[model samples]
Target: MSTQRKIVFDAIGSVTTEQYDDPHAALEPGQVRVAAKYIGICGSDLHVLAGGHPFAQPPTVPGHEICAEVTEVGPEVEGVEVGDHVVVDPIMACGHCRACLAGRYNLCEPPMVAGFRAPGFGRTSQVVPARNLHIAPRDLPWQVLAFAEPATCARHCVGRLPESARENVLVIGAGTIGLSVIQALRIMGAGQITSVDLDPTKRQLAATLGADRTFAPGELDPAETFTGVIDVVAAQATLTEACTRVVAGGTVVVMGVPSGPREIPLPSMQRFERDLVSSGMYVPSDFADAIAWLADGRFDAARLVTDVFSLEDAPKAYARAQEPDSIKVLISLSD
Candidate 1:
């Protein structure tokens, strides 16, 4: 039921780790226990480590981008069982809430998010709701399977747009989120995808993954105004420039979320004329499609995984992601 491990915090800038009781709570009727195989080092995880974001109160287990295999299942868990491979969908919500009824569970007021908002599977073992699990692709590696969550989020955003939306797309930020959005677009058959970021490492990775074109920071503004542009850079400075790039009557997906109030220009409102639509978290339909795409070999999930480290070095992994140039990085929990 309980175990001990080092709990680290502010881990992006300085070392913050300790041995604490990492518990594997009991499974509910619709739950399963998983032996975590891969725990990705994401920007949000680094936000906690660097003291830059408000994900958790610190001294908490730090992993949300996770992939694992089911080791146990509750009696009511029918679709999955022991020895089955699966990926965890970490959102926890109350079914009675209005948002839940509307199928917008991510906006649940009393939200229970895994990793940050609740207990997650990054530790040695964890019990999660069966509804939160999907049978993992037998052929996919744990490292690549871990992207299911973010990729699901991006796919949900793409699905919301009109079916007639342009095939040419632009993604700002070559970070994991940006790259994940690009991958999701590929799953949907978007004809061309362009990625832009200041970091060459990220751009290069974007090109490797699927981006048809990669542009430098300021170098991207000159490219064709996109029918759809995703803004993963949430800072006011980044948002302002991104807004300028969204074409009129086009769709600009604002996936970037930054902390604190932002400064905005009145001129930025003109982009709304471009039919701005915002999206959040994974919707069920979106997750399903992304998972199927992963299983379908439409894109190479395995190739996206560029770096892996031991759980003990998780803090270092976060540090590397925050570096000037960092690609997809993950943590292997097994000894």
Candidate 2:
């Protein structure tokens, strides 16, 4: 059998193409094969290439942000069919695990995401459990449909907030996740939402995506303003700053991940008893919410994309996406 071409990286940040045996075997009665339309390169993929991520894997096909057309469906798959456009949920959890039973599958014991451990979408095709597929709205572009997985993460954050606290929200960072937070807030009836980011491009993108106000972190007033604040950057310093910048009675949501070991003065932030809620990964419900929100035509999210590169150019796309002002990078396979 011939092999397929896949992009893999070395330990020192070098990218190379490798040929593994062709994987055209039919799904084992319950799997789905998706023909790649496009996949988004995540920051973690770049971190893995740069040897900065904890879950680094060299000689691995890296792409979890995937959108595609269903090329084949297993016998048990009742809904998905050939030629049906869909997005991958990308959460490969062991169904028998306790966390999976409780619906907190992201915390599945022996956690595995296909793009990280199994074959990924940085190739012509990939297969996963049909449960991982989320049907995209027929009206949404296939490019944006690729975001359903991350949209799930964003929906998870919004789900954590009180329904009444949707108005006058503050979102920190202008990356894809931040923009997702903005979209969620707007959908829930937030009257005036604000976003803060150092990158002007992302801030502008946030504004275009329904953020009522966009400000550089340096330009925000530290007067304990805003009813709710979401820190998606996950930097200790940035989160600390976000914590301090929010109003006393407000809720501070930390979805951004940061490196190990950081300090924050608890006494300094005790003035108004701010609610510090830390969030982890998503559940199936969050992803369902994300798909439903994507189906909603309230906002124009195509502006979130700034670049689309072919799988052959995955390395360069990963490199350039690290630019200070870059928003999101898409990797196209069918085009």
The lDDT of each candidate is 0.71, 0.76
TM-score of 1: 0.87
lDDT of 1 by residue, 167-286 (tens): 778788877678878877876778788898888877888898889999897776565576777778877766666566666666767788767676544455564576666777776666
Q: Pick the candidate with the highest TM-score.
A: 2
lDDT of 2 by residue, 278-316 (tens): 777688777667777667755345777778887778778
The segments of candidate 2 whose C-alpha lies over 4 angstroms from its true place after superposition are: 1-3, 267-273
TM-score of each: 0.87, 0.90
What's the true lDDT of residue 32 in model 1? 81
Give every collision pair in model 1.
6-18, 7-18, 8-16, 11-49, 12-49, 30-130
